[model samples]
Target: MAGVVKTGILGLDAMLNGGIPEKNQIVLAGGPGAGKTLLSFEFLYRNAKQGNNSVMFVVEEEAEKVLENAKGAFSGLKDIDDLVKNGSLSVEGLSAVSNASESMRQSSYEFGNFISDIEAIIADKKATRVVIDSTAVLEILVKDPLMFRKSMLALVVDLRRLGVTSILTAEMSSLEKQSLSFRPEFFLFDGIIMLYLSGEEEKRMQSMEIIKMRGSKHSFVTTPYDISPAGFKVFAAEEITQE
Candidate 1:
């Protein structure tokens, strides 16, 4: 039997019936300014603090810049720097060395090599938890939707084989419950977590929902959450009464 990997976020753990199933690939989908990046960092930060060595791989930005920004944004997590220095956590950025468009058109060798680099990093760090900042840019990298799906499927397989529970952030255009746009990722991951924003201006409120979790009995209730300097504070016990 497989044990659960605690996210270390109490409310989130409750929603997952304890924690994400061991080695599950979770898609954390939301729109711009939805706090996706911050939440991803916190996942690593919290888990690392709990002794689950973790690594964060970023594609859209530099690792140093991301870490610096996170430090400023989350003032309450004062020990983030110490965790990194102690080698319990890693935040690194990835660059596409080859022209993804041309390279992927020929074969999937580039993508395979890409996963290899990630595998190497995980091994070097002995990381049990992983986070890929976001995979939305893969469309531009792969170009062909068919190959894109293949690449995502391949990624899913590789991450599972690596024996690490991972989160792949996704960009979404809609936050509404019934109007979410269909995408390949909706089917590729072992679990789907939807982060939402509603209302407008200062009146805006954030919420989360567990759309699906393959093997676990997860809550379908959409719960409210707040992003303080303390990181993500999910209110798993309280459901969003309405939009």
Candidate 2:
């Protein structure tokens, strides 16, 4: 409890052996429709409810749309607006391609502006938790693979140095991790969780697996989870055998 950063997501926290280690950057990898955004927001929402300041940085989509979607989807979370208004939870969009200068936009390595904006927001909010919607948008902004990895590593380092536990979502194509290849940047983070859809179309289900956690022993079994109006409920005590 003293050093761990609790996600407050019921079974998720139990899987982490309490919660994520302080200042560890955890990547949430999943395919489309895997409830990645909702899960990430829940992490922030739950923690914020417990009084830890949290912030979410949107890479491509509008921030308000994310807020509204969360409100509509989680009918039980009636206080999301109140959290935002009270400054406990903040969702801000960051776009390097749109507002950056022509030179920075044209250069693959000039991503300092994005970092600066993020740092400013975190500092302003005194946030202890952070989430970056999806890292794919950052990749598109930097076409060079090598530079993208470099910039990502730099971003991870900055976040760690800032002393905040954060989540970075990655986009994947639908089943079996067959889509959305990730770069070596993942090695820069402390933990990895793969959330994907399984089963035939008619019988599909959402599941989560913990790939690695640096300082804690975590569950390796692919566990089943489903989204509900109350939020996400993870069946960590049971394992779902893959076909």
lDDT values of the candidates?
0.83, 0.83
Q: Candidate 2 deviates by what RMSD?
A: 3.5
Q: Residue 136: error of model 1 in Å? A: 1.3
Taking all chains together, each candidate's TM-score versus the true structure is 0.90, 0.89
1-243, model 2: which lDDT tens digit per residue? 338888888688777777888889999999888988999999999999999999998876878888898888899888899999999998886443235434444664357777877888899899999999888877877778898889898899999989999999998765574554554888998999889787788799888888888888777777788887788888877343322
| lDDT per residue as tens, model 1, 1-243 | 898888877588888888889999999999888888988888899999999899998877778899998999899889998999999989977543234334545556466676777788888889989999878766567768888889888888999999999999998888765677658657988899988888888989899888888888778888888988887788887443332
RMSD of each: 3.5, 3.5
Clash count (model 2, backbone only): 0
**lDDT, residue 241, model 2:** 33
